[model samples]
Target: MTGFVELARAAQAARQARPQVPLALATLVQVDGSSYRQPGARMLVDAEGRVLAGAISGGCLEGDVAARAAEVCASGRAARLMYDLRADLETIWGFGAKCDGIAHLLLEPLTDWRWMAQAEAVRGRRLGGAVVTLLDSHGGGATCALLDGDPSPAKWHVLHDDARLLSLPELLPLAHSTMRTGHALLHTVADEMTVFIEPLVPAIALHCVGASRGAEAIARIAHTMGWQVTILDHRPALLDELDLPEGVMRRRVRQLEAVHSALAELPHDARSAVVLLSHIFDVDSAWMTATLPLPLGYVGVLGSRKRAGQLVEHAEGVLAARGTPLTARLRHKLYAPIGLDLGGESPASIALAAIAEIEAVMHARPAGFLRERQSPIHSRTPSPRVLERDQAPTLPEVPLRCELPEHPAE
Candidate 1:
């Protein structure tokens, strides 16, 4: 979800900078085996075959995908490109991609920028939604639509060139299920049409309740991970002195009494995370007490076990006096001693551990080695049913050396 947001922002910036440059979008709709990126990953390609942002593969597949995208931009037609890298990749395809996988991508020209506009509308809205694309079985046509709002027929809106796919009643349930589960899915109706539903969720919001050295480190690390980061401190001087990444937000929180109001201005959804690392006991305590009742996903306090216990005990007393006891639900959300058990005393190492822990908690995963796991590394959604070979027609073959005409100026 966060990756899609970054791609959306990049595509938007590129369009704004050069509106006359024709562009195409390639979406990885399916992958069957070991791969660098999973389904729903995207890359934007211009007429000159430059990758603006995002990536569908590590580095081996972008060149070919960009070449195909140029043809899409010239013809204004959607095409499906399949790469079978399961065996003897160097001998068969000469690409030397050691990854034993099969990848399917959908490339379409950006004839109208309505899809981009809809994506920008919900980029940071804190609302979960889905993008549904209907594709031809023969790879001749494609239409894209956006689904946002409650699970009601009247509220679900579809935008695209084709109105026939938009009126399909069966797509609503599939799109709703994908959004609810936060998973991407590919579904085929008989052998005529295939639907790809990609979930869109807001990026993780990290509240660094400090402007200390540790806070700066955490902000930089989280920003690299595509998380929304904000550094809050009681002293404006400390905040000014702190160096942060380009997109990191900073707030001067003046008084401990105004902690609630300060937090009110930030995100309060279940995707939100907070770390009380101010090092000032009174300020951390105040923020901790205020955040207990909110809908935050993770809350961490940076200190030793003894200090963490003391801080929580004080918060428990304060909440108890207000006739609201600290329940197990609230206690489970607090991570004292704030990080995974990665052994390091430096601020940078500590920041890495803390970010790792928060990511695990937010995704409901156990922080353990992948080699020890029994299941696949990536989560599995419902698999696409196999279409009959006779019924599934192949896409038109475009020569590798086909010359694409330059995009004419508007």
Candidate 2:
């Protein structure tokens, strides 16, 4: 969703800016065993077979996808492309590459309105579910149904004719599960009917308090990764002189004494995060004093362990006076000395390490060296390879349409 968001916007702009041109879309719905990209990654192609946005593989499969997209564009029909990147000495696709995966991709002519709606929904932070679903029409039973709005188990805004998919008792549970756990699944409703579920929960929000060198780095990296970014400072003079990046929202607040006041300004909920980088213990405590009581994805202070403890003690005093003792869960979630140990004294390096920690905490993943993990570098599932052969199981017949992940393409 992150990769597709920017690309979709670019493609839409290009198409509207130059209506004479035609464009196409490609999305990797499933990847088996050691794929360069994961499921839900997307790309955009033009009539001339140009790469507009996103890349499925590092460089192994874009050319093929682009070529196929061109053919699909000419024919005005969607296509399912297969790329077996298994390292075989016989095939050029595996040439000198540590490839051993099969990629299932959907190629279709670009739809501008749909792409814009999708990107905007993702960027707008109005949605909740992270899993992205691609309803495949490859199984012959094709339908026009596609859900693109803020999806909840209770309701789904189907974009096309009545898919009636929500009526399935079995599917509702699966949908609920996917919402809880951001997992990708390809389910076969019938012979030739499949649905790829790849929940792309919108990027998490990161609020950087008190702009500084480290704050700048955090904002930049967080923005590039498609995280909703807000840089807040009570002091206008200091924040005014700071050269923040273009996308990072710079906000001026009178004070951080009341969380509601700040939240009212932003109107963010638990999915949002707040990091204290003021380097001033009193300021950080004020932010944490208000932030700790609420449910946020992450709350951290950019300082040493001792500083964190000091702020914690101070925040506790403030909270205790207000008749609310900070709970154990909140304490556990707070990182006093925020960020992983990347061992760099520079502001950028520290910022990188810190944001990494924040993100890990947000996703509830352990922060550790990737090499240290026994599983694959990108472990959505331990056995994605097995998915290729024993694909979706047979189910009752139902009309389907391969709903690829949308881009703004906001």
Candidate 3:
């Protein structure tokens, strides 16, 4: 079972044990600045406003969410809360504390079995789709099904004032977290006024190709991040050495044929990320040869530049013979010299950098040092905007001074 499945099960158990208590489910539907949970991150809050499962933010924000959850449970109404740390004193006092960047949370009282049933059904099918429509917002309610389909709406449920037709092709590639605003429309897709369709699938996956020290660290880090980690290695000794948890799957294979066979058996999805950290170049070559062409979220390989280049060259020839053109984007996605520029030689440090790079790639971000970059450390801008309307101003270049400020002569 996945981490989410376990969380659901635990929440169910808690609910059963305390039948009298009402449960409020709070999910971090979207994040604007640096926050702990990403989009679709969920946490179960009991009637007493206690956390039963999941994390929505770092320790700084959970207490406030829990308190609000109590109020939500007391009243049967759903609340769309935006937590911003940069708010003025009045807003901060009203919202409890400022979180700096905005974190949009959907807190709904879980009194109906139907909502839980829908979640359970999605979990059983392992299908990823979002329920888009604001419960309290101004937009009309309409659910968009995101399963692989033609550019047409499939099933229509409850109708509201603002009906908008959206082609699935136009919506899939765009980030799912963003929403637009507009009036009701029936024909063409609108760029504005659409509630985001949030998928139920976890946006993180751990793909381990070799059971080396690096692989072990990767698995551990991914587990902490609530990702589903799958370990595939040819050496039984490597698996035995790691002493991984029961949740992690260990696949034993000798050749690329075995690896391909194993991957073919499993269902491939956008949320999955594949990492090949095997010391054996042949095994790495075989895995890369099989995975690179597939539409994977992220593919990382552990090796030096020279070694990765050689493997890629061989793989390209192999793929070319099969009539599959290896693109440049796919090549860059396959990090031969895996990990960020952390200048680490140790296996553990290398693993940290590799996992960091994987997360950065998953989020479509640059894996650079935050201190070195001039941009806001945590803020994300969806669109560029002019800061001022006037002409561009130039400042005189100032010389750097190493000495301390001199005392003024009084």
Among the numbered candidates, top TM-score falls to: 1
Lowest summed lDDT window (length 10), candidate 2: 139-148
Worst 10 residues of 1 by lDDT: 398-407
Better of 1 and 2 by TM-score: 1
Off by over 4 Å in 2: 17-20, 88-94, 129-171, 267-270, 381-410
TM-score of 1: 0.85
Sort every candidate by TM-score, greatest first: 1, 2, 3
Candidate models: Cα lDDT each: 0.78, 0.68, 0.61
* lDDT, model 1, position 47: 74
Q: Candidate 3, which segments miss by more than 4 Å at Cα?
A: 1-7, 27-41, 55-57, 80-84, 87-106, 113-127, 137-196, 267-270, 374-410
Q: Candidate 2 residues 180-288, lDDT tens each?
A: 4656666665434576655545567888888787888888888877888888888888777777667778888776555458766663565678889988767788888
lDDT of model 3 at residue 148?
Answer: 20
* Model 3: lDDT of residue 204: 67
TM-score of each: 0.85, 0.83, 0.70
Cα displacement (angstroms), candidate 3, residue 159, comes to 14
**What are the root-mean-square deviations of the candidates from the true structure over C-alphas?**
7.9, 5.5, 15.5
